[model samples]
Target: MRAMDEATVRHVARLARLELTEADVRRFAADMSKITDFVSALREVDVQGAEMTLHPIANRNQWREDEAQPGFKREDAVSNAADSEQNFFKVPPVIE
Candidate 1:
Protein backbone atom coordinates (compact mmCIF):
# COMPACT_ATOMS: atom_id res chain seq x y z
CA MET A 1 0.00 0.00 0.00
CA ARG A 2 1.26 3.48 -0.83
CA ALA A 3 1.54 6.07 1.95
CA MET A 4 -0.90 8.98 1.83
CA ASP A 5 0.95 12.07 0.55
CA GLU A 6 0.09 15.76 1.10
CA ALA A 7 -0.98 16.09 -2.57
CA THR A 8 -3.41 13.18 -2.17
CA VAL A 9 -4.76 14.69 1.05
CA ARG A 10 -5.23 18.07 -0.66
CA HIS A 11 -7.06 16.38 -3.56
CA VAL A 12 -9.31 14.48 -1.16
CA ALA A 13 -10.08 17.70 0.76
CA ARG A 14 -11.06 19.40 -2.50
CA LEU A 15 -13.35 16.45 -3.42
CA ALA A 16 -15.02 16.73 0.03
CA ARG A 17 -15.54 20.51 -0.48
CA LEU A 18 -13.11 21.24 2.35
CA GLU A 19 -10.65 24.20 2.47
CA LEU A 20 -7.56 22.86 4.21
CA THR A 21 -4.34 24.72 5.06
CA GLU A 22 -0.84 23.32 4.53
CA ALA A 23 -0.64 22.32 8.22
CA ASP A 24 -4.03 20.53 7.97
CA VAL A 25 -2.90 18.72 4.81
CA ARG A 26 0.30 17.53 6.53
CA ARG A 27 -1.66 16.29 9.59
CA PHE A 28 -4.31 14.57 7.53
CA ALA A 29 -1.71 12.95 5.27
CA ALA A 30 0.06 11.36 8.26
CA ASP A 31 -3.24 10.26 9.83
CA MET A 32 -4.49 8.75 6.57
CA SER A 33 -1.18 6.92 6.06
CA LYS A 34 -1.42 5.39 9.55
CA ILE A 35 -5.02 4.32 8.93
CA THR A 36 -4.09 2.71 5.60
CA ASP A 37 -1.18 0.84 7.23
CA PHE A 38 -3.45 -0.47 10.01
CA VAL A 39 -6.08 -1.63 7.49
CA SER A 40 -3.40 -3.31 5.37
CA ALA A 41 -2.05 -5.12 8.46
CA LEU A 42 -5.59 -6.39 9.20
CA ARG A 43 -5.45 -8.35 5.89
CA GLU A 44 -2.81 -10.65 7.48
CA VAL A 45 -5.35 -12.04 9.99
CA ASP A 46 -6.95 -15.45 9.23
CA VAL A 47 -10.67 -16.13 9.86
CA GLN A 48 -11.36 -19.16 7.67
CA GLY A 49 -13.47 -21.03 10.27
CA ALA A 50 -15.29 -18.00 11.75
CA GLU A 51 -19.11 -18.05 11.56
CA MET A 52 -20.76 -15.02 9.97
CA THR A 53 -23.44 -13.19 12.01
CA LEU A 54 -25.30 -9.88 11.98
CA HIS A 55 -24.55 -9.38 15.69
CA PRO A 56 -22.15 -10.91 18.23
CA ILE A 57 -25.01 -12.13 20.49
CA ALA A 58 -28.43 -13.59 19.68
CA ASN A 59 -31.24 -11.05 20.08
CA ARG A 60 -35.05 -10.99 19.77
CA ASN A 61 -37.91 -8.56 20.42
CA GLN A 62 -40.07 -9.33 23.49
CA TRP A 63 -43.78 -8.56 23.43
CA ARG A 64 -46.36 -8.40 26.22
CA GLU A 65 -49.81 -10.07 26.05
CA ASP A 66 -52.25 -7.91 23.99
CA GLU A 67 -55.23 -6.39 25.81
CA ALA A 68 -57.98 -3.86 24.97
CA GLN A 69 -57.70 -0.39 26.63
CA PRO A 70 -59.72 2.80 26.74
CA GLY A 71 -58.82 5.30 23.96
CA PHE A 72 -58.93 9.13 23.70
CA LYS A 73 -61.82 10.87 21.91
CA ARG A 74 -61.31 12.60 18.49
CA GLU A 75 -61.84 16.07 20.06
CA ASP A 76 -59.23 15.34 22.74
CA ALA A 77 -56.69 14.17 20.15
CA VAL A 78 -56.92 17.41 18.06
CA SER A 79 -57.45 19.82 20.99
CA ASN A 80 -53.70 20.77 21.27
CA ALA A 81 -53.12 21.44 17.55
CA ALA A 82 -52.46 25.05 16.40
CA ASP A 83 -55.19 24.57 13.76
CA SER A 84 -57.80 21.95 13.01
CA GLU A 85 -60.38 21.18 10.30
CA GLN A 86 -63.38 19.05 11.34
CA ASN A 87 -62.11 16.24 13.61
CA PHE A 88 -58.58 16.21 12.14
CA PHE A 89 -55.60 18.54 12.74
CA LYS A 90 -55.07 21.04 9.88
CA VAL A 91 -51.57 21.81 8.63
CA PRO A 92 -50.19 24.31 6.11
CA PRO A 93 -50.09 23.14 2.46
CA VAL A 94 -46.64 22.42 1.05
CA ILE A 95 -45.68 23.39 -2.51
CA GLU A 96 -42.81 22.07 -4.61
Candidate 2:
Protein backbone atom coordinates (compact mmCIF):
# COMPACT_ATOMS: atom_id res chain seq x y z
CA MET A 1 0.00 0.00 0.00
CA ARG A 2 1.18 3.51 -0.81
CA ALA A 3 1.54 6.19 1.84
CA MET A 4 1.25 9.72 0.55
CA ASP A 5 3.16 11.93 2.97
CA GLU A 6 2.32 15.49 4.09
CA ALA A 7 5.26 16.93 2.16
CA THR A 8 4.08 15.23 -1.03
CA VAL A 9 0.55 16.50 -0.52
CA ARG A 10 1.76 20.06 0.09
CA HIS A 11 3.96 19.92 -3.01
CA VAL A 12 1.08 18.70 -5.16
CA ALA A 13 -1.22 21.38 -3.73
CA ARG A 14 1.27 24.07 -4.67
CA LEU A 15 1.61 22.68 -8.18
CA ALA A 16 -2.17 22.75 -8.60
CA ARG A 17 -2.36 26.40 -7.38
CA LEU A 18 -4.28 25.38 -4.25
CA GLU A 19 -3.92 27.33 -1.00
CA LEU A 20 -4.12 24.80 1.82
CA THR A 21 -3.52 25.40 5.51
CA GLU A 22 -1.29 23.20 7.64
CA ALA A 23 -4.30 21.38 9.04
CA ASP A 24 -5.65 20.79 5.51
CA VAL A 25 -2.30 19.42 4.41
CA ARG A 26 -2.12 16.97 7.33
CA ARG A 27 -5.72 15.81 6.87
CA PHE A 28 -5.35 15.36 3.10
CA ALA A 29 -2.11 13.42 3.54
CA ALA A 30 -3.83 10.62 5.44
CA ASP A 31 -6.79 10.59 3.00
CA MET A 32 -4.49 10.48 0.01
CA SER A 33 -2.52 7.61 1.52
CA LYS A 34 -5.65 5.52 1.86
CA ILE A 35 -6.72 6.38 -1.71
CA THR A 36 -3.34 5.30 -3.03
CA ASP A 37 -3.54 2.07 -1.05
CA PHE A 38 -6.88 1.27 -2.62
CA VAL A 39 -5.53 1.93 -6.13
CA SER A 40 -2.49 -0.20 -5.42
CA ALA A 41 -4.75 -3.04 -4.38
CA LEU A 42 -6.66 -2.73 -7.66
CA ARG A 43 -3.39 -3.22 -9.55
CA GLU A 44 -3.21 -6.81 -8.15
CA VAL A 45 -6.46 -7.89 -9.83
CA ASP A 46 -6.40 -10.89 -12.21
CA VAL A 47 -8.59 -10.43 -15.30
CA GLN A 48 -7.28 -12.49 -18.19
CA GLY A 49 -10.40 -12.17 -20.39
CA ALA A 50 -12.13 -9.07 -19.03
CA GLU A 51 -13.70 -6.68 -21.54
CA MET A 52 -13.11 -2.95 -21.02
CA THR A 53 -16.29 -0.83 -20.64
CA LEU A 54 -17.17 2.62 -19.38
CA HIS A 55 -20.32 1.29 -17.61
CA PRO A 56 -21.74 -2.03 -16.47
CA ILE A 57 -24.62 -1.95 -19.00
CA ALA A 58 -24.47 -1.47 -22.77
CA ASN A 59 -24.99 2.14 -23.92
CA ARG A 60 -26.10 3.88 -27.13
CA ASN A 61 -25.52 7.33 -28.55
CA GLN A 62 -28.58 9.56 -29.00
CA TRP A 63 -28.27 12.71 -31.04
CA ARG A 64 -30.52 15.35 -32.66
CA GLU A 65 -30.18 16.08 -36.37
CA ASP A 66 -28.52 19.41 -37.22
CA GLU A 67 -30.67 21.89 -39.13
CA ALA A 68 -30.33 25.52 -40.22
CA GLN A 69 -32.90 28.04 -39.03
CA PRO A 70 -33.66 31.71 -39.43
CA GLY A 71 -32.57 33.96 -36.60
CA PHE A 72 -33.18 37.52 -35.34
CA LYS A 73 -32.78 40.36 -37.82
CA ARG A 74 -30.05 42.92 -37.05
CA GLU A 75 -32.33 45.99 -36.82
CA ASP A 76 -34.92 44.31 -34.59
CA ALA A 77 -32.29 42.52 -32.49
CA VAL A 78 -30.35 45.68 -31.53
CA SER A 79 -33.42 47.90 -31.13
CA ASN A 80 -33.62 47.17 -27.39
CA ALA A 81 -29.85 47.33 -26.75
CA ALA A 82 -28.80 50.04 -24.31
CA ASP A 83 -25.72 50.45 -26.52
CA SER A 84 -24.79 48.94 -29.91
CA GLU A 85 -22.92 49.81 -33.11
CA GLN A 86 -23.16 48.53 -36.69
CA ASN A 87 -25.33 45.51 -35.83
CA PHE A 88 -22.90 44.42 -33.08
CA PHE A 89 -23.01 44.57 -29.28
CA LYS A 90 -20.50 47.07 -27.85
CA VAL A 91 -19.07 47.47 -24.38
CA PRO A 92 -16.27 49.32 -22.60
CA PRO A 93 -12.75 47.88 -22.98
CA VAL A 94 -12.00 45.19 -20.36
CA ILE A 95 -8.22 45.45 -20.67
CA GLU A 96 -5.73 48.17 -21.57
RMSD of each: 8.7, 7.5
- Pairs that collide, model 1: none
What TM-score does structure 2 among the candidates reach? 0.49
* Model 2 stretches astray by more than 4 angstroms: 11-17, 67-96
lDDT tens digits, residue span 1-96, model 1: 799999899889989999998889999999999999889986788978977788988899988779876899899999999999897989888775
- Candidate lDDT scores, in order, read 0.89, 0.88
Tens digits of lDDT, candidate 2, 1-96: 668988899899999999999999999999999888888876789977987877988888977768767888998899888889998878899899
Local error of candidate 2 at residue 68 (angstroms): 8.1
Using Cα atoms with residue i matched to residue i, what is each candidate's TM-score against the true structure?
A: 0.45, 0.49
**Candidate 1 positional error at 85, Å:** 29
Best by TM-score: 2
